[model samples]
Structures are given as C-alpha cells and as structure tokens.
Target: MKQGAQGSAATGAGDVPGSAVRVPPQSRGAADADVDVDVEVGRERYDAPGGVRGEHTHSETPLPRPRPAVQRASVRGQIVDALRTALVAGELRPGEVYSAPALGDRFGVSATPVREAMQQLALEGAVEVVPNRGFRVVERGRRELAELAEVRSLIEIPVMLRLARTVPAERWAELRPLVEASVRAAASGCRATYAEADRAFHRAVLALSGNEQLVQVAEDLHRRAQWPLVGGPGLRGRAELVADAAEHTALLDALVARDLDVVRALVGEHFRGAR
Candidate 1:
C-alpha cells in the first residue's frame, strides 16, 4: 500500500588601495605577541589591486551553496507514490509489463529506485515480478473487486458497529476532517486523491477500535479494492466518487449519534456500492 536565497556585499576601509594594513590584534596590541591568531576565511575570495598582487590574491567567486540532497529512500517512496497514482488513474493498465528502466525514464529517475518501488508494490500484490523482463500490473476484474469489498465489509462493518456502541460520540466526531477530505478529493475528480482519502477515512474509523491488527488487515483490503479493474470502467467517475464520499459523511454522523442501525445500513450500502 502507498502510504502515502541571500546575497551580501561588503566593502571596508580596506577597500582603499593605500589604506592602513589591518593587522591581527595579537600582532599589534595583544600581550601574547608570540601567540598565533587563527583567522577563519570564508568561501568568498578577494583579489588585491594589480599593484599589490600577492600569492593569495587571485580573482575568485564564492561557490554556490549546495542544494539539499534527495535521499535514496525518499526517491523510492516517491516512485511508489507515483506508481500508485498511475494505477488508480488507469494510466498503468493492468496486465501491462513495465520495465524499471522504462518507468524510470518516464519519472525522470534512475532505474534502481523504480525497481525498489516495484518490489514494494509486488509485496502489496499490486504487481508481479517477471524474471528477465519487468513487473506486470496485476489484472483484477469486477468479481475480484466485489470479493475484496465483501471481505472488507465483513471485517470493517462489525468493528464499526461495535465501536459505535462503545466509543464516545466525540471520538467519532474527530474523524470529520478525514471525511471532509474525502469529499473534497472526490469533488476534485482525481481518482488517485480520492482513493487515498477514501482509505484514510476508513482507516481512521477502524483505528478507533484500538485493534492494530484489525486496522492493518482492513486497510490492506481497502487498498486492494481501490485498484483499477482489468476491464470496464476501472475508475469511478467524479459523480460516483462524490456519492461514495457522501456516504462516508453519513456513516460518520450515524456513528457519532451511536445509531447502530443507521451505521450498519450505511456501511452495508457503501460496501455494496463498492462492487
């Protein structure tokens, strides 16, 4: 699962071609005349006037500050994220073989990170590795999608119902932001964004159950359901996503009200519609 400037200029009296030499304090007024004074030189270089040319006096410009380095882990994670988005958007068609080097060129990254990201996807069951070739996007159909949704419903609906009875209304209300995020993402018509927000909302709700194992299992199932189908419309249209998101809001309200019947109904309908 995708788990988603300054410039400065300075001139001194030393600018004067014939100004008094700025000697070190130790050289002029310090009690310890024999003591060495270490002067830390900056990157900036100064050139002496032509008449006073010295060995150290040559034209030089300060090197530009190094840009922040992109870590290898970060690159791999980004590739994973991008691949997930592509999967949801149907841009990465199911059953299509994609080589790491080819996808690396598409993402403008090195093939190593792409390969690492593909390996992670393979673990998630989003793709399968093909020896001497590349990874192939797993082909999922409506039947599989429905099965995943049913499994999720079997796991999540009971937990949510139990939580509704035990967990406080305020606890459920805290998930409003996640539900609203789903709504906004759905309205934006970005399947990838909506997919993530959808999972996040459900995950947050399940997390209230205080069962990490349940949450993990439910989240994995939820992610699998969101993957594109092999045939037919793999991704829902904006209207469908919006309607689905609205059910989340309604479900949240029912949970907050501790209406077990309403929560159960909403959850059942939501999962059915997921098919």
Candidate 2:
C-alpha cells in the first residue's frame, strides 16, 4: 500500500492500513504469546451497544512480530475509532456506563492506553469523561442522525461533484480500485471490509477536492453519522448490498463522464437512501 497525504500506507504481512483516527492492527499481549492461535485477533474490539461486530475473521492468521511498547497516540487512535464505530453502529447506547479498566481488558491492553483513548473520544463528542468517574457514550437521537445526514449532504455532495471535475485523470486511476474493491466486498457480504474500503474511496475523493480542512471536517462528521448505517447490525441482505454496489458503480460512471449534475444527484440519492 502506498502512503497518502493523510495517513501512512499499511506495512507488514498481516497489517492493513487504517485511517489515522480509526485503525488498529490485531496483536496479543506479550504474556499470551505461546497459546495455540487460530484466530488472529485485533488488540481491541469495537463492539456496538447491542454487540455490533465490525470487520473480523475467524481463520485469519496473526502477524508474527514482537509487541512494541504502547504509544499514547496509537492507543488513543484505537480507542477513538472503536468508540466512534460503536456509537455509529448503535452498540454503545447513549448514556451507557463504561469502565476504562473493562475497556482495557477487552482490548487486551492495560488501563493507561484505554484511559488515553477515552479522553480523545470525549474531545470528539463521542463520549463524555468525568473527572472522577469514568466515560459514557454520548447518545445521539434519531433526529440528530437525520439532521447530521442533511448537513453531510450539503457539504459532501457538492465536493464530490466538484472532485469529479477538478481532479486530474491520473488520480482517477488511483481511485478506481478503491471504489471497485468496495463494491466487490459489499457484494460478498463482508460489510466490515466493504465499509473500510468505501471510506477509503470517499476519503480519496475528498483528497482530490483540494481542501484539507473540509476533508478533515467531513471525516469527523462521517465517523459520527454515516459509519453506523453500514457498520450496524441492520446491514445485511444481498439485495441491499447489491444496491450499494450499484450506487458505487453509478457514481463511478458519473465521475468518468464528468457529469456534475448526474454525480450530484447520485450523491444526494446515495445519502438519502441511508436515511
């Protein structure tokens, strides 16, 4: 994987590159090294409030490497991404009490890393951390989700339309695989993988829009609003997945033709479908 302006390329045999805010590779603690490892486990699980599972596999092999000393940013990144995913997926319901220690246990790490992660999440509006008490997942009402989707439409759709025009042809070559791969993953019922790939595709489009700040804001908003729709338990059924795949293809065709009106309408319809 090639590194992009916003994040590093995924390195290592089993490692997958993740967004700066939402990615963490699976690895075990130093003490559990000798066990018979069938499932390659992520160091943390971002379970939604009702136990919504994200991208994972049973037969995947663990990466063979020594655990590096924990870094604060990395731990915080994992926590933020996990909690954000949970919030979007409606797993960690609003007002739910969460213990830093329990989170630490769940991720197969120590309390310090979990605490660090929670603090970052609180700053992002995904959770609230009291000084003496632990953290709580912030509840977003359905109305809030609707309003958020509206706001995202206002911001993202035009940019996506503009990107189809302004971005150089060479960059389109770079982006094609991201969209096609996402469609393939979604078609195959790997929702988690599809979600990840879809995010990369959109982010790649945002990158082409030539506005870094807008891209950042869009990502923050997306983490809270859009992710849950696909990441949540409600995501299933081959028909729905096929529809999503078709949407991606339609968007691609519009981009290729530089049909701003068509792509804009497609973007609007795509998000409205989520509602």
Residues 68-105, candidate 1: write the lDDT tens digits: 34578889999999998898888989999999999999
Off by over 4 Å in 1: 1-70, 232-235
The TM-score of candidate 2 is 0.64
Candidate 1 global lDDT: 0.77
lDDT of 2 by residue, 120-148 (tens): 87777777886667887775656777777
Q: Residue 22 of candidate 2: its Cα lDDT?
A: 29
Candidate 1, RMSD to the unseen true structure: 12.2
For model 2, the local distance difference test gives 0.64
Q: Give each model's clash number.
A: 0, 5
Give the candidate number with the greatest lDDT: 1
In terms of TM-score, the best-performing candidate is: 1
